[model samples]
Target: MNGSEFARPIVGLTTYLQQAQTSVWDVHASFLPGVYIKGVTLAGGIATLLPPQPVDAEIAARVLDRLDGLIITGGKDVDPATYGHDPHPTTDEPARDRDAWEFALLAGALRRHLPVLGICRGAQLLNVALGGTLHQHLPDILGHTRHQQGNAVFSTSTVHTVEGSKLAGLIGETSDAQCYHHQAIDRLGDGLVVCARDTDGVIEAVEMPGHDFVLAVQWHPEETLDDLRLFAGLVEAARNHTTERVNLWPPPN
Candidate 1:
């Protein structure tokens, strides 16, 4: 059967564990903002929340086996120690479980050759996971408060996408991007190329060429809620990938 004849492509999203409180219960729970899920759904993909992997062996690889795409979500700051750096005063405490889990998930997805999207903190995670470092604090480097407008809010910035880059092909060379992060890409990771940047020359988007799809952006695409181009690309790639996998299985057995 063709991919179009199948259910929506299953897109796995990495979530964070938070000490959540609600009218119903107060406990540590795995959760992600509805916006992320909503974005994937609106893009015609099936969204699955992938909480931190349990202690089972090969958890990430097993999960990757069932997933058509992977999304590493934005979250708390990555530990500076992971990338061999001294912590900056402004850096928040590390989301240890999330960092490790997402790293493994990314590795699994890469091995499986699945499309991956990394947003905001996820972009930083991609960099860190691929042997790169972060700036930790943008205010110190730029001496400005432009990248991050306010807490629990996003600042609008105009980023220039590289001409002829994959991102430019989808969203054009220039667009208004919704951004919220103090830490940005410092030393680029192996196999990653900058595709977009803000006026301050901060790296806003990165793409892993030669891969199916490995795009990470420092901005919040879910905030815009209208530009589904990137998400749609992921879904299409996932659909195509699912079709390929289904055809490859039971290899002449």
Candidate 2:
């Protein structure tokens, strides 16, 4: 199908709540990768944003039912308890609301075989959702240089290793990425294969070879636009899935 023939895909972005006010919240929203849809749209694809918060299972399902793909954005550390562990001293308290909402959204997306792209905490959530665990605090246990570089905002770093992987093939070897988290994947979840890691052996990327399009990265791809191949891949995959579904069932007579 031509790009214009491809309908605009609604991408879901998970958000985080500010501590000060119960109602106040911040959506670590980004347009870097989202902008890729523009190119897709220009090429004939559509794109829309779906923020993750006040998650309603019914709403999530309805959204996923219509969306061609989903993108889970980065945020604070996930609670250790979700994966069966006491809270680590270094671990930040879990966002119960976000956790509950995202868990449902991920489950629904997976069940439907919709394409998913997870970034940072989104990656961790995917792991936890699939019965995996996290390191909680990298510096305390991993013995690696600070992954969360001293920057309140996003900070860019070098991602070494460019072998054979979807991510590597998309961005090539040695691409600059933003690091903003202290936690790393400890025990990989089921059906997930480590695709990329740092020199220190930290899991940077994970993929489900059997799934339609399940890819997760620990870095913030949305922080950089030049390397939006990842998002473009997702949009393309969604477009294909949508086409396949339509082809499987012709319009009513």
Candidate 3:
């Protein structure tokens, strides 16, 4: 089918804390737009935004039920306590509401086997949700340079080793991804396999074997939509998933 023929895949993004008057949780408009632009430019799908609050199981289920797939966007650091680690001296604890919201949404998506693409902090959230742990602080624990380079926003970094996994195929190689994070995964979660790592031995990508499409990356693919391949891969997966579901059960008459 042509790209437009497929339904626009709705993708949710987790928000961060903002100060409109007081501390209100919010996601940037560009966050979803960037992801959507990449998907449309590459695989011909659309994205719909979802808030990062009131993360009730029922609400999450409803949200996932409408979308063809989901994209968990990046944000602040996750609380180390969630992964059994003592709080890092340099760690910035993420908003508890944002964490709760994303966690609930992730749980709902997994239960339905919905295609998910998580970036940066979103990747860490996926890992923690699946029973994994995080390093809290890469420089302090892993003894690596600041991965969050300020000179170039969304710039590429050193190459990593792709372990013959789905992500390798998506990006075409274990080349340098757009690095922008200070944390890394420590203990892996249940059902997740480390797909890529950097020179410092940091877990850069994780995937679930036999899943519809549960891929999370430490890099920012949305920021690099010029490389439409990654977005194309995700949109294509969502399209195929939608087609399969329709074939299995036609819409109610």
Q: Which candidate leads in lDDT?
A: 1
What are the TM-scores, per candidate, against the unseen true structure? Answer: 0.96, 0.82, 0.85
Clashes of 2: 4
Per-residue lDDT of candidate 3, residues 1-253 (tens digit)? 5443467665555555544332574434323435544554456776566656666899888778887777788777887777777877778855777788888888988888888888888889999998898877677765655587555565466656465788878775667677888888888999999888877777888998898799998987777666776667777787777777777675668
* TM-score, cand. 3: 0.85
How good is model 2 by TM-score?
0.82
Error of 1 at 65 (Å): 0.9
Model 2: per-residue lDDT, tens digit, 106-140?
99999889988898988999999998999888888
lDDT of 1 by residue, 1-253 (tens): 4645465999999898979998999999999999999999999999999987553339877888889999998889999999999999989888788888888888878777899999998899999888999999999989998888776777899999998788898899799998889999999999999999999999999999998888999999988778898888888889888888878776885
Candidate number that wins on TM-score, 1 or 2: 1
Steric clash pairs (candidate 2): 3-44, 4-44, 8-46, 41-45
**Count of backbone clashes for each model?**
0, 4, 0
Clashing pairs in model 3, backbone N/Cα/C closer than 3 A: none
In angstroms, give how far residue 151 of model 3 lies from its true place. 7.1
Estimate every model's Cα lDDT from 0 to 1.
0.89, 0.75, 0.75
Least accurate 10 contiguous residues by lDDT in model 1: 52-61
